[model samples]
Target chain A: MKRAAAILGIGTDHVYEVDPDESGRVSAEKMEEKILYCQELGFSVFFVGITAGTTVYGAFDPIEDIAIICRKYKIWLHVDGAWGGSALLSPKTKHLLQGIDKADSFTWNPHKLMSIHLQCSAILIRHTNILMQANQMCAGYLFQPDKHYETSLDTGDKTIQCGRHIDILKLWLGWKARGHQGYAEHIETLLEKANFFYEIISKREPCFRMVIKPPFINVCFWYVPPSLQNIDQTSLEYNERLDKIAPRIKERMMTNGTMMVGYQRLDHHPNFFRAIISNPATTKDDIIAMIDEIHELGHDL
Target chain B: MKRAAAILGIGTDHVYEVDPDESGRVSAEKMEEKILYCQELGFSVFFVGITAGTTVYGAFDPIEDIAIICRKYKIWLHVDGAWGGSALLSPKTKHLLQGIDKADSFTWNPHKLMSIHLQCSAILIRHTNILMQANQMCAGYLFQPDKHYETSLDTGDKTIQCGRHIDILKLWLGWKARGHQGYAEHIETLLEKANFFYEIISKREPCFRMVIKPPFINVCFWYVPPSLQNIDQTSLEYNERLDKIAPRIKERMMTNGTMMVGYQRLDHHPNFFRAIISNPATTKDDIIAMIDEIHELGHDL
Candidate 1:
């Protein structure tokens, strides 16, 4: 989202930020504070982006509260539900994205959690003709106003691309094959598996530490080796050692051809593993095997 | 390219143009004049875009001549070969892109002339690491500096997209299946077919009019219906009548479910058909059939 803003010539200086809370979720109060600050400096805050699922901790920002603020200011509320939009398919998980329908626009990626093919994403706008107004090149060769058929149905003028790939066909086929019920079941199963992992890691105590209670399918945790088990949590030595553990264990995992899990340092926290349960094919045994492999690789470090 | 510039906040005010000559090729003198004019107004003329194969005319800009001016002005020279870059494959047509190697960067889409699957495109840079420097986010989770292997080869940081679809695999497979020699032959054959179409249209005088001598595999021409056959070319009535012919013929073509050809007005010319011979499956019989179909559907109009 920041990259997209940068491409549109909005430099870092122009981008105001509201830091995430301890749970890694953007708070409504913080967002309103930032908006007020920017406005005080004579900035017209036209767009307010609220992420449904953040990248690191699977955090879902309070969209309902933020939407109220956005409505008060008459700002365009855009929800980037790229990672968490699929949760809306399941009745049990739909509450996480509570105020998404109230958004002026929403970005959803079927590729992330829906397990559709890569690059399958959509931006749905509430108003009609706005996209065409913003992106139309009016290339006479392509979109002729005097065509026999209705030119309004010709959506090519609604985006920057003159020639787009048939990405929709695959998404449609996938959706048809897996009906709404099938998709709901898929989401429920992934969430169950993620919850199971979180519970297992929580019980493991000093050996493993849950960074925060995961709100989505991402289970982020730190595998504390025996050497640093007794180290004081506040000491510089503990975090310094904890930071190096994830990379070392990751290297071993890759070298051994066991499993692939991403690790990274998040605000104030050292390097930790972020296990995503998006794949439906992952078995219970596979999850156990992943836990066992991490233990075997990092226990003595 | 203009869309990309617009995305980067380079509006029409910043975008200066050096108009193409009669054949639709960008002359070096005109480019130098435009650059000097922009510089005189205290505007930094930093980039000069030279098209290897323009979309409408299939005209290759004089790259060798333009490169000298770009070098003199210390400007970045980018060649948009989205339409015509495949000419470099054939020895017969390679001379058309003589000074492409001197360009700072070149965009080539294999999906165009190469007949590869859609969305297979690449931007070739003259220097290495520049792309990484410009686009890297240094996201600690993805691009770790202290990885066991050479992290420099990790190309995810070299673009705005954190997760890009593997567009290179299909392109690589297509290249492998069709060797360099086979590709050259494919390009040469397409160019030959385009030339044949051009020849046939040129001979069909009163019924047809060649827009310009095509430089590459895009044969642009006009279907002069019986009503406009005797009309004076300079009159407003002739151009107005001419302009409506293509849309009418195009509507008929779509309704009849025959060949698909794009039509557009360029510069002072009225609507003309741009028949591109890019697909290897297009045969000589098909070319003849297209011309016959256009006449059968349009000549009376």
Candidate 2:
């Protein structure tokens, strides 16, 4: 609905990029080329999805590219960092999102990685109240003078939600509990864990490949059975048939109470499993247990 | 943000009501007229806010006025029963929410009175998948063919939110701990306490009004100054100014640690105090104490 609204709201719009993976990661060259492609296409607005890294037109560029591209093309750059964005607090991952301050408007989900509960998302526009200007209800009931929220910065009045859930308290409490440095340490720890998983899994036989490498959390791995091995016929049927297998395995694994792995057909690959590690409770032992469970259950099938 | 989304995405809205004075009651006739006025204004959607009171518009209607008007106009009806919706389980109060079943959607907040943690708000739609139809973001990585959430329901995908917080456990636990009739009993007890206050306060002051009268958990009262004789312009300003005066008293009350009374402006009068009796710790003694405190402090002013 929001997407359709955006499209309809603007007479003609072009998307610079959208991450198909939803993995909260994008590639460097994908970013650079997308900017260049938009410039070539003579598109004035470049809406970039920077929530998570799932793009690989290959290589990752710092956010400075946004300034560079906009300055070059005289285009408006909008960053949709809707998720995995609260990592901005971490000293370790803050470097990962360098030069984001240059973007015209950026959305960061405090609700996601910041652990502030759902709807705790914040969209900081370098230009203030841009969304308010874009979307207006013009109802006097919303702005009628009041004593409680006397300043009229009800926040709800300026937001997309009517009677928004007060997710701020959760953020406020969480921030109070874990100071800025504490939150940074938390993200740093998660990054270290993500890197650990990438190191352990990427080199394994039949592990296939990861989407966009070590630093990213969602490590995508494909399993090539010995029977289907070495035959590189990329038939549509071969792709569709292999797609049917992973869910069956996932279904049985969940029911059997051993382990459950997320599977989907990403691009050309018939079927693949994606292990998204975000839970803080997850340990190295759990990782080893998960891999062993996957192998033991998947090897025979 | 939800409010803005409703107004922008859904189109046109109004917030015609807020909690009334300490009485926690509003006139049923006034409510009916407001709903009718909304009809006159060509509102296609009726989002009823039925947290407290004998909300009889949609639920009951000897004339079936709201429904008849809605059916005539093909209006979409929704009820926001968030704060006090659990009253649906109470035999005494369920009549207040008569035609709720006819609503397209209903929002119930368990966190309000059920001791459930925050963020446990549920939007129950008559037709399922409307939320998903409204907010699904398709991607290559997360949502795809042969995925765990495909052809089968995984409750999580139906939300605009991702990495959804686990709000069900607290509710499920409440249901288990306080079985079927137990919750209803809780509501009944609370209502009984409300009635107790209403009965005593009415007996205490002959000139005192219940706003919407008895059988309501909330009691709106006015202390007719020894000088007042009529509900004229002076009385309105008197009420409004008096409402502001409570806060000055409240700050001292907070420091004194004796009791607390919330004051706010209402449509019928200027502004007045509103007391929410949901606090189980409250008793008839506390009510009397609060009154005494008000009189002691307010008499001079």
Q: Evaluated with TM-score, which candidate comes out highest? A: 1
TM-score of every model versus the real structure: 0.97, 0.76
The DockQ score of candidate 1 comes to 0.61
Q: In angstroms, give how far residue B210 of model 2 lies from its true place.
A: 4.1
Q: Compared with the true structure, what per-residue lDDT tens digits does model 2 show for residues B175-207?
A: 899886988887777777777767766776633
Candidate 2 fraction of reference contacts recovered? 0.25
lDDT of 2 at B124: 86
Cα lDDT tens digits for candidate 2, A1-301: 2344442343224444434333334554566676767667876543553433322211233567556756565655556555546557877666666778787777676766776656567667887776666665544323334333354465545655444456667788999999998898877777777777777777665534454464445566655444444455476655565566567667768878887677766556656777766667789888877776666665554
Question: Stretches of candidate 2 above 4 Å error?
Answer: A1-49, A52-62, A67-83, A86-92, A104-193, A233-245, A279-289, B5-64, B113-115, B137-140, B144-151, B204-210, B223-240, B255-257
Listed for each candidate, the true contacts retained, as a fraction, are 0.54, 0.25
Q: Which candidate's lDDT is highest?
A: 1
lDDT of 1 by residue, A71-94 (tens): 999999999888888889999999
Alpha-carbon RMSD of each model: 1.5, 5.8
What are the candidates' interface root-mean-square deviations? 1.9, 5.9
Total backbone clashes of model 1? 0
